[model samples]
Target: MRTQQFSRTARSLVAAACALTCLAAEAAAIKIQSRDPAGFGFNDPTPAAPVGGNTGTTLGEQRMNVYRYVADIWEKNLDSDVEIVVSAGWEPLACTATSATLGSAAAWNVWRDFENGKPGTWYPQALANKLAGENLSNGQPDDGTGYGNVDIKTQFNINLGQPNCLAGSGFYLGLDGNAGDAVNFAATLLHELGHGLGFSVVSVQTSTGYRLNASATAYSPTGLPSIWEGFMYDNTARKSWLEMTATERRQSAINPLQLAWTGPNAVAGAAITLAPLPVVKATSPAGAVPTTPYTASSFGPAVPRSGKLGVLATITAQAGELGPGCSPFDAANAAAVRGKVPIINRGGCTFAEKVKNAQNAGAVGVVLANNVAGSFAPGGADPTVTIPSVGVLQEDGERLKAAVAAAKAYGSRTQPGAVTASFAIDPNRKAGADLAGRPLLYTPNPLIGGSSVSHWDVSAVPNLLMEPNISDDLTLSVSPPKDLTLPLLKDLGW
Candidate 1:
């Protein structure tokens, strides 16, 4: 829930293009058409036309150019034939949503059938209407496969409670990165368009996710009812799409920070990465600094040791926490661990599993002292978790564990302990650990709207463009740092 401030400087850079053209020779090129929502007052900014996503303050041609830029990035890289209709307009910002939001999007008449020989797929109906670019004159070809025929619709935000449409906020809407307190419009466009391409889940989830909404005349490769619920993956439940129960699927969307995208295109796109150097630190309750252990959480925002941090108490007993190496860590222990970092032993399960349990139980951050040896990078693959987590050295872990045991014998969730400490980000560390040379998406325990089960997770070397909220320092290019949105488009059956 931390809001990005206005400070970073923008670096002028061209969107590094990618090899995203559709595979089939007959596949029509991706057509991106922009429109002003009918009857809605929409004003173009200043600076008119430009070369990339950012267009300064100028509206009209400039803003449209940025929209075209986003379309160009996707159109050129995606291997599909379909039209995306975009609607730009102004709307009141809800007190609950991000004020900087540029807009929102949704796929129209959507349906899915395995395209790359995979199961539980979701594709636009317009794309599924034809094969490659083959003629659809004979009643708009019905041979199920590839992209569809109808156009996908989207709405962009021209006003976030602002009167003068061109008045700049702490956001840069040009081809450049954040320029003296500005958000990149190009990058924002990319994120919103990605959602329209089916990077979103149902806000009100049902047993089968939201209905496919495709007409009876629409394509349904599986004859089964189509829904966004059919494409989700729950690691904690180890269930993919239809395999999950209604509850599991709904929970997946709620805790997006910990979920994974199984769509071939999403997985493939997620294969992308950027160089990372996040500065995060976790000192023990005793004030002693631990070893070089670090983490790349896909959930909570990264903070520097030089900045403000979460709880620093030594973890004694937990509440509702469970796992092989876990003990009485649950709600009953909230009084002792509330708002404090809980130190827990590792092993018997994944690093993510332990943190998820601890975080959901009300722990702000978790210091997972390794049950085994040398420091290794920590990981996050679920949505329920939203706290900072780290893997301290074995010795360091034991020190915290010992301190807890001495203060309050036998990990009892109800007993308070004398373990009082603090934590901070490792300013010297700079960035986070490079995640296995690939980007991972975050699926939290309880999902965050719009951000649930989408975007690159913490493992990415440097923060990527599609990581929930776009980073100000992000570039205008379609390169990894500036362009993960297209890669995901490529993954979602392009």
Candidate 2:
């Protein structure tokens, strides 16, 4: 992450001007340059059947096509004279039976103080090139180790969905949005490219909240801010990142829902892109509990706005860690949980498994309590799990537990409707946006490296392309009326 600062140096400006003059007059194009070696990665010779509007006949060709398609989408939405080059490849990134790094990308380099750029703000290489009206990169071939002529460097998981590598979930090369159980390759590309184009900040250490210095060699308390930080508003601190100290910025990064994107375009985009967040509200407990936010499970039917009203109960495990509710509840536990919404601890099993067991135990609805702090929309699909389910943060779950215990101690479960609650969408609050219609950034406590403070909050309805997680519901659209990515880019002066 080098931040090359431009000056009034005639030599540099003339070089840039010469590069721009050499290009043919045409709309800016995003070029996908393969960085893979022969017989592997993007060069793999494996045969592949065309599917979902993708006509490539080989594995590598299909992967390349997805990249090109994503690039074309960005090119169509953006205006620039200099062509943006993305160096992309495939590699065996981290993978497991449950999770995998489908892909990752970042700006190859950053620039500041360039022509038509904000002073003291670092712009990503591609965006910098657009603003400067010239190609500023070294224009060297990439070997997957360092930055060069490329504006963005990206790589995907080659062994994905193979044995021992997220075994059952691989990349779907289809141009159509029907990814089914596999990850959508084009959607992932769109997301990574957004980061490269300008969606991410160049924080040397997010925990310290330090941006790269002018030279970009290291982090500093007085370092230049990334253009992305200009829109990072901390509602709790009542200040934007541009107005905060490093210490204050660090605190705001972990403030969860407190950090929001204050860009006007994003704010307007959120109004149409996001829906009201679904939450669990305890009406009987009233003043005893706060309205709790939840992430709806992708597997079940959408949580109804009408709400599911029931007594909240906890399931007991015959044997397990913290009663995760991995296995079916026994007869006694079933009776206790029957006709109620059971709050099951996360982990020990898939969300679908837990919900299916709760449904079998006669649960009308379910709440999957986070085993850890923070919240995420629970993934996986199970057609048989008919009851709706939502996820609550660990602390929120604790609050619910305490409320239930208090109510239970005071009154009988059947008599006064103890622990009575309803899980439903709250029309007052947008899912991933603040009350002011600004979209919340992913600012989890304890800081999720590469995720926190960079991507959109996962609670976003319809799932924006810039969210940390690649959702199954994302479309190719990156502009307004359907998506917020292009709007946000426009905010960054795209």
Candidate 3:
């Protein structure tokens, strides 16, 4: 990613001249030129204007407008003067009979038409070289570097099954909010544009961490290193892309708190109110309060609840209740479980089964103790559970368990501390820059490929419009105070 440093006075002048929303006139309005008009397959050549837009426009025309809307947003804010090459037409992007991919975008002509001297192949990191101005001989016309020479491919799925915007029917084609009537193409297209603009890495992810697909043995000139690597930081390992192990880097892709984007442009003009994560505070009778971080259970209701959790000394194992806590379970001590949070180990069966057993024994909530080191969302299915649940670090679990034992041995008064804890959503405040002044690229757990490291965490507060999954209840936006993506583009020398 590149950085475009501006003077404080210059910024102040722009802020003064334009509303916080945007500049009165774009510094440079990047054009969106269409490709292969015949491929779009529209008869009229002109599509309708979208909902609330020019009413009499054609569907094909309406589709182009949405693409342009996304392009306009990028053109208005990005520091680039180059035109974005866009192709918006219908194609059956079906992976199956009923499902299809919505769209995709990427840096173009940044790769060699051939791989490793092959006549027609390209490595993934080739784009990084172009972004870095390495100008590697990729068998394509040199477009210089430090900026994109083409538009991000904002393709759509015009599959046969859905009355969706991409299909030119079910979605509201305008740049306005939908009343649950249609899909919001503007939001979806913006996300794709974000990727094309460098909100992605070409590193290959594995079951563990990520590895560079291409070897980098040089620095400059030959374009040995990928510039995108400089931005990825793993807080868990307290290391950047260069310092992490393959497994460490892979985990960073999903380790919400660990993964971050440390680029000058990303955090530029930074003002964040990060949504805090829930803190499990254990108040002792001694008036001491100790808090620990936790991961919410994947299954069960999202209701955040706080109260005392009763611990059962019995630990369960995986394999659908193979160990203790099985039916006819002696672990279901009514005295220990009735109406209280059931704190138990995460093992012996599915999380759903474990919670089901707890609920059957009168558990008001469930607190799972992690057997692994770092915390992750507890995975299991329990659709009928109405109570909230959470997972704590093993260390924290041990302490909480011991406290329960102490409470059992002696009365509440003699236990020395309050045994209650609170489990609820902790909307974080924005993650400020680390010591190096690099901002974070937060993507929450249950990590997905293609989506990881490419977008903000889904749970991020103040609404991260770039999360992998586009919410139906979204409106298009691209500035800070509500979004951080535009600044990232500027940092990449957009």
Best by TM-score: 2
Tens-place lDDT digits, model 2, residues 272-355: 768877778885543467888888898988777655558898766676543477788889879878899888888877999988
Candidate 2 at 171: error in angstroms? Answer: 1.1
lDDT of 3 by residue, 228-329 (tens): 555677777778865666666667776655566766545543444234555566644434445655656657776354554433333334344463344433
lDDT of 3 at 234: 78
Q: What is the alpha-carbon lDDT for the whole of candidate 2?
A: 0.79
> For every model shown, what is its TM-score relative to the native structure?
0.54, 0.89, 0.61
Cα deviation of 473, candidate 2, in Å: 1.1
Candidate 2, position 190, lDDT: 90
**Superposed Cα deviation of residue 202, candidate 2 (Å):** 2.0
Q: Show model 3 residue runs off by greater than 4 Å.
A: 1-25, 30-59, 94-101, 111-149, 160-174, 179-183, 203-223, 242-256, 268-271, 276-278, 284-419, 423-439, 442-447, 472-475
